[model samples]
Target chain A: MNELEKRLLDGFQRGFPLTERPFAEIARQLNAEEDQVIGALEGLSESGIISRVGAAFAPGGIGASTLAALAAPPERLEEIAELVNGFEEVNHNYEREHRLNLWFVITAPDRDGVDRVIAEISRRSGLEVLDLPMLESYRLNLGFDLQWS
Target chain B: MNGIPAIDHMDRQIVLATQEGLPLTARPYHAVAKRVGLEPQEVIVRMRRLLDQGVIRRIGVIPNHYALGYLGNGMAVWDVADESVLEMGRMIGDLDYVSHCYLRPRFPPEWPYNLFAMVHGHDRGQVLERVDKINAVMDEDARAHDVLFSTRILKKTGLRLPT
Candidate 1:
């Protein structure tokens, strides 16, 4: 990719626009047209450089949320992943390199739902879970600017 | 200055498109377009605007923290002499394994943890060892350092673009 493409990719990682005709608005600033902006983002996604272009909600702003993980055997990794992914509340899941190999985040309409989902995962996957709720939020902003970097 | 920044529906669509389908190939834009129903060029331009406005930060892959084998994830909070907090923040943020570092508004009697920095390692022992390394480099008068190892993670996603 060219330098311009790199810059574009870097920019999108922070956040996406939350307005009508957001692409056109972005185009107005980037010195490019709406079509060009849209195309570039699509290319970025195809390239594996940027994961996705969407809104990342502030924790607890949307609903109840919790970070949970499981200690699963290698043989059952696939099955466990499927079970966790089945829940709509399960947004992100990763196989971290730890005794807690299966890590995921679940958000629901309320605290009760969050608890119920965890219980379901335990029953179906047959793995013990470690649920970590946010005790204190210190500095929660994850926005990063690439042009500055 | 008055408003955080106002956005529109198209802008929201772009964010949704990217989040839903992150390209994993050489031509990410083309890949995203197929999913979002837009051309590669359009995606590129919109991203640039988001960057300029400081809405989007950088676009990069977040390596699986565990995949890198730095499994010991802990939030180390410190009560430093207010005078040296800024200097110390820079020092801590510079750590190779410290993915996030910052100072937040302090609420006394209820919240005392300040000067938060996230460090990860392969195990508790490794994480603790690094914490020791951090402590060793500290200047005098920095007190009450504590590590809150994340017992679990609830949600880890990018910022929600105003929609």
Candidate 2:
């Protein structure tokens, strides 16, 4: 990555300008033109170094969400993952290295929605769904501290 | 997201529009406003409200952890005493390498863990070391703990706005 790109990735994780022209504001900080900053950001985004330039919501602050898991046999892993992801509510699903391997997150407009999805998945998969809802959060995402070295 | 005040139709539009992310442009909000069929000022106001309300934690660049070389990702789960979960969670969260720490429900007789901390490192060895530090912190108060490394990221489509 180029120097400007490094700074863009490193420095702009948080506190992105909320002004009328945010790119221009970023440009001033990085000593680049507005279009150049925008172009660099676009390149970073396309390259998949950055996911997006937007808001990170507070989990369960708007809609109810729960971190859920299911243990799928090796043969049924893909099928079960598909089944879980089939719901619009299942946002993140991961194959963790454990017996209870299929970990996922479900978000819905309300507690009932979240519970219904979990119950449905549990019923369909025939595997026990672990509904591990957050009791308390110990950390706030201030943005990852990307190490350049 | 918890404690969401009733969002109007327009605010919901703005959330859905930006949920994927904002447009990469000189006037990204303007672009979002136009697409969502609202004026730029209104979009800005709504977004500001969302941020202030904690519905939107922060408005900024979201980086991919894997792309950023955080290869060692593990969800370390500890079966700790219920009374001390908050204290233990705070202790774990204070660690630099631990990205997230939370007290989650445990499914006993099968899964027995309450405290979950997401530890990130450039590789597994580093992650293990960090997990070891967590073990050291709790000592015997942690009845048992296990680090479930992510073998594969099957899906990571982040948070979805409830439709």
Best by lDDT: 2
lDDT values of the candidates? 0.61, 0.86
Query: What's the fnat for candidate 1, on a 0 to 1 scale?
Result: 0.09
- Which whole-number lDDT from 0 to 100 does residue B124 have in model 1? 82
Worst 10 residues of 1 chain A by lDDT: A140-149
TM-scores, each model vs. reference: 0.53, 0.96
For residues B103-138, write the lDDT of model 2, one tens digit per residue: 888898788999999999999999999899889989
Candidate 2: list runs displaced more than 4 Å. Answer: B1-6
Interface RMSD of each: 8.6, 1.6
Q: Label model 1 with its docking quality class.
A: incorrect
TM-score of 1: 0.53
Cα-based lDDT at residue B158, candidate 1: 42
C-alpha RMSD of candidate 2 = 1.5
